[model samples]
Target: MFRTAVGAVGLLAALAAVPPASAESNSDYSVLIISRERLEVATSCEIGVYLNDQLSGRVFQEQSTSFNLPPGPVDVRLRLLPGQMPGCAAGIEDQRSTRLNLQAGQINKYRIAMGHNGLELRRASLGY
Candidate 1:
């Protein structure tokens, strides 16, 4: 009888120690950005992607890093950082920025010519 009581107490403790299930509505969405002509590695260009006129994140092709952004409308702007300044800005007549229109759980990508090195902003087409 004592062993049974001990077992019952242990069982009760174990049950109490169990973690409760979480009740959270997970946001299901993801996106990935790639250059139009494929950005070269070890370059000085800095790619800045914005979402809904908001700053999402910047990507340096030299150091491969993932930009974590929630699924939604994103406005992307590609610019050459201070170091990659001349090539992206100098002589290049077209460095226009681009505005991206995306939805939840969708991947909106933007492509630009390496020559046009200004700020070409355009509306994102959710084609694929």
Candidate 2:
């Protein structure tokens, strides 16, 4: 009994030394943008996605953009990067942030629209 107790205590101590899961944990996500107006050149525009205020990836008018992240809730924001923002990004506001509760093996999609007034003038979410 004494040896068993000592081994159990030692095992518990080692386990407790491990780091806890972070709330900032997240998972990979696939993003798609469709121009509600009309289909533009594949590489004529730039799209950027930000997770928890950090830049995750960018898309240059791709049909879809995918990114991998750690697992939890993430604030996904899409914006126009560099030369893709001739309509805005200078003064006019153009960006959208979507909150997603993510888990491993889960998928999410975000749709943003580009307008003459701003990037992502509108947003639509499909599927959980």
Candidate 3:
């Protein structure tokens, strides 16, 4: 019984030497998706998606793309680019810098749709 007590105390001491988990170690991330809600009128151009004024990706009609980003505020922009489709023309540009307020291990969705002024980036509800 005395040997058992000493071994248990030694094990406890070793465990206490280890550092505790930190909040930063969690490294939470957010998932963002840009979905083309519908085809543009008189145009078949692929829209350019920009993150923080840098070109990220392009989305075509009925297509979608996703990004895994750190949880925080992000700047997103969208613009219609010239495409191979005949009669397609560049439309107005859209941009927005919004805070997602995302939580750890959560996903955020956005819909890319055309508004009266130009392209739009709106938050969309998750299906699942």
Candidate 4:
């Protein structure tokens, strides 16, 4: 009985020395939030959000989406996606990309706005 108890205690100590497999450290990533809560575009078409030239998410009016990315520079692009609505076809607008620097453990928020040239992203406060 004493040997079994000692073995059990040794196993417990070994288990306690290792960390859980599901443990994730949040400091390794940064949060990116894109919102389209305003009527700046004044269109009903869904906007395609691209990261590193890849489509990551889509946002419509009064909607928002977020992503957790590694700490580095990320290319962000916004364009109107061809949807079920009229005049919402591809190749109708200039496709431009913007570069954003992301830091570790930081939250960045941006809102869609109509720029002088085309659709763009503008920095927004976190209160919303």
Best by lDDT: 4
Estimate candidate 4's RMSD in Å.
3.7
The residue pairs found clashing in candidate 4 are none
In candidate 3, the residue pairs with backbone N, CA or C atoms under 3 Å apart (3 or more residues apart, or in different chains) clash, namely none
lDDT of 2 at 123: 45
RMSD of each: 7.1, 8.1, 7.5, 3.7
Off by over 4 Å in 2: 1-43, 84-89, 94-96, 114-128
lDDT of 3 by residue, 12-121 (tens): 99999999986654447778888875554334677788888888999887888999888877888788777787645764444554445666567778887666767777
> How would the candidate models be sorted by lDDT, starting from the highest?
4, 3, 2, 1
- lDDT at 63, model 1: 35
The lDDT of each candidate is 0.52, 0.56, 0.75, 0.94
Q: Which number leads on TM-score?
A: 4
Off by over 4 Å in 1: 1-27, 36-66, 84-97, 114-128
Tens digits of lDDT, candidate 1, 8-109 = 999999999999998543345556555433453335666555445455666565332334466655555555444445664433334344545555655545
Across residues 74-117, which tens digit of lDDT does each residue of candidate 2 receive?
Answer: 77666656663565343435455666766665554555554564
By summed lDDT, which 10 consecutive residues of candidate 3 come out lowest? 91-100
Model 1: how far residue 18 lies from native, Å: 9.8
Clashes of 1: 15
